[model samples]
Target: MSEAAIVIEHVARRFGALEAVRGATLTVERGEIFGLVGPDGAGKTTLMRMLAGVLRPDSGRITLEGIDVAADPERAKTALGYMPQRFGLYEDLTVDENAFFYGELFDVPRAEYRERVTRLLGAAGLAAFGRRLAGQLSGGMKQKLGLVCALIHTPKVLLLDEPTTGVDPVSRRDFWALLYQLREQGVTIVMSTAYMDEAQRCSRLALLHAGEVRECATPAALKRRLPGALLAIAGSDPRAIRDALADAPGVQGTLLMGDRVHVRVDDGGLRGPELEARLAERALAHAPFETVEPGIEDVFVALVGGAA
Candidate 1:
């Protein structure tokens, strides 16, 4: 494994009566995408802000590329780019103008700025929109522009807070493509997002809730942490099937997904038949049931539900 580009150690932050981050700790390996997955009020933003040196943690330590962030914020920030949920962009300025402004702040030479900006804009699909005012772009385009601005300085690590929250699906897809490209270029990315599917794209993720770290692992590894086998049943009425399995023997939990009901069985071999018998008793005998792989959302619900 590569050296960790970012290290967080038992970090805690509080705001008056609220403990926003409680003993949160994780590491982001060099050149990998690490995701902070959680729901609102889960402290994702607070944690990211602390990492970026914008907000200091009341306890614990944060280090970027081995430099202590709290002890030396300026040195730590030089090697990283922090993009908050609402990136501060001059709505009145054109996209290119905004990029240039950031470039100037980072002190990139005029010639170097021109070369990097041209490539970055073209790669981000914002080359044509360079002349468009920042406020005129759609939600996705605005995000892409924010990303371009954040990358203008070419920092070693990038921290983004919910970059795709309100973006359209297609735009979200485009944004992720840009991230992958950056990863390929050896940029370490640490991002926070509420989207479970988006979490799947991360190389590794830390699942958080109520300011606590529930679990941290690769998406596949996290799914494997699920207690038992997952079984999906599709019936004439998926909701009926879900209800039928709600408290069925050997059924750990049940979730409704599209036209199917996914039930976590304590034992695939032993509980599979029991589930069928229970469904039969409930007049759902004809429902189709098969053991299936658990998705990240399933594992998240299982872990968080159990914690709750």
Candidate 2:
């Protein structure tokens, strides 16, 4: 295989007492959608900023597409498209104007950007809204416009920071569909998302927790890292079921999943009946316990020893 699109070696960043990212190391293959999966304050943004060359790491190194980000940020940026959590679009400007502004920032010529922006806008489903003020667009539309602006220069690597947070479920689905389209065109995308479902879409993932890279693998591989089988016991009292299974035999951990409590046991076939019997003892009427497959969040939760 060719060299990876990005390579990070022992990268670290600290802010006074808080070390935002700690000795992180990973590789992103070309044209791969590599996800930095974690919750808030997990240093996804810090690591992304370092990758964008906007923030310097306190120690270690980062390289984007063979260019050292810290040593040659300007050159690195030419091949990078960064869309931060808040897409920094000029509110007073129309969608077309905002694209023009970013194009100018990237030093793309008017003739080139005009033609390029048209294609990008059309691809992002914002062709008809070119004249609409950025401030007037809906949240989902704003995000799409932000994406359009980021792609104005047609960079090789796209860095998105939680691009779907707070977006409507339908809009989120649409946004991901667009990302998949980009992937098919051979763009190397390194994005950070707290949504485990979103993380599942990545070609491979690096699970970040408290500034540390917990694991790096495909979504299926990560789920397999979760030792033991999963048993989803649905009950009106999920909390009660979860608590009741805490000390149950062969149980590793328990988490409340809305109306269901997903309990991790050493063996599902062996403990499934045991768990049901234990719940029955407490008079908690639960749906027939299902030996379910674990998801990305379930693995993350099990890895972190609780909440995901």
Residue range 1-308, candidate 1, lDDT tens digits: 34999989999999999999999889889999999988789999999999999999999999899889999999887899889999999999999999999999888889899999999999989999889999999999999999999999899999999999899999999999999999999999999998888999999999998999999999989987999889988888888878777877877888877888888888989988888888788787455678888888788878888411
lDDT of 2 by residue, 1-308 (tens): 45699999999999999999999999999899999988899899999999999999999999888899999999999999999999999889999999889989999987797789888888888999989999999899999999988888888999999999999998898899889988998899999998878999999999888999999999999987899999898878888888888988899888777798888999889998888788889999889988888988888888877641
- What overall lDDT goes with each candidate model? 0.90, 0.90
Error of 2 at 262 (Å): 0.8
| Colliding pairs, model 2 | none
- Pull out the clashing pairs in model 1: none
List where candidate 1 sits over 4 angstroms from the true fold. 284-286, 306-308
Among all windows of ten consecutive residues in candidate 1, which has the lowest summed lDDT?
299-308
Cα-based lDDT at residue 83, candidate 1: 90
Error of 2 at 267 (Å): 1.5
The stretch of ten residues in a row with the least summed lDDT in candidate 2 is 299-308
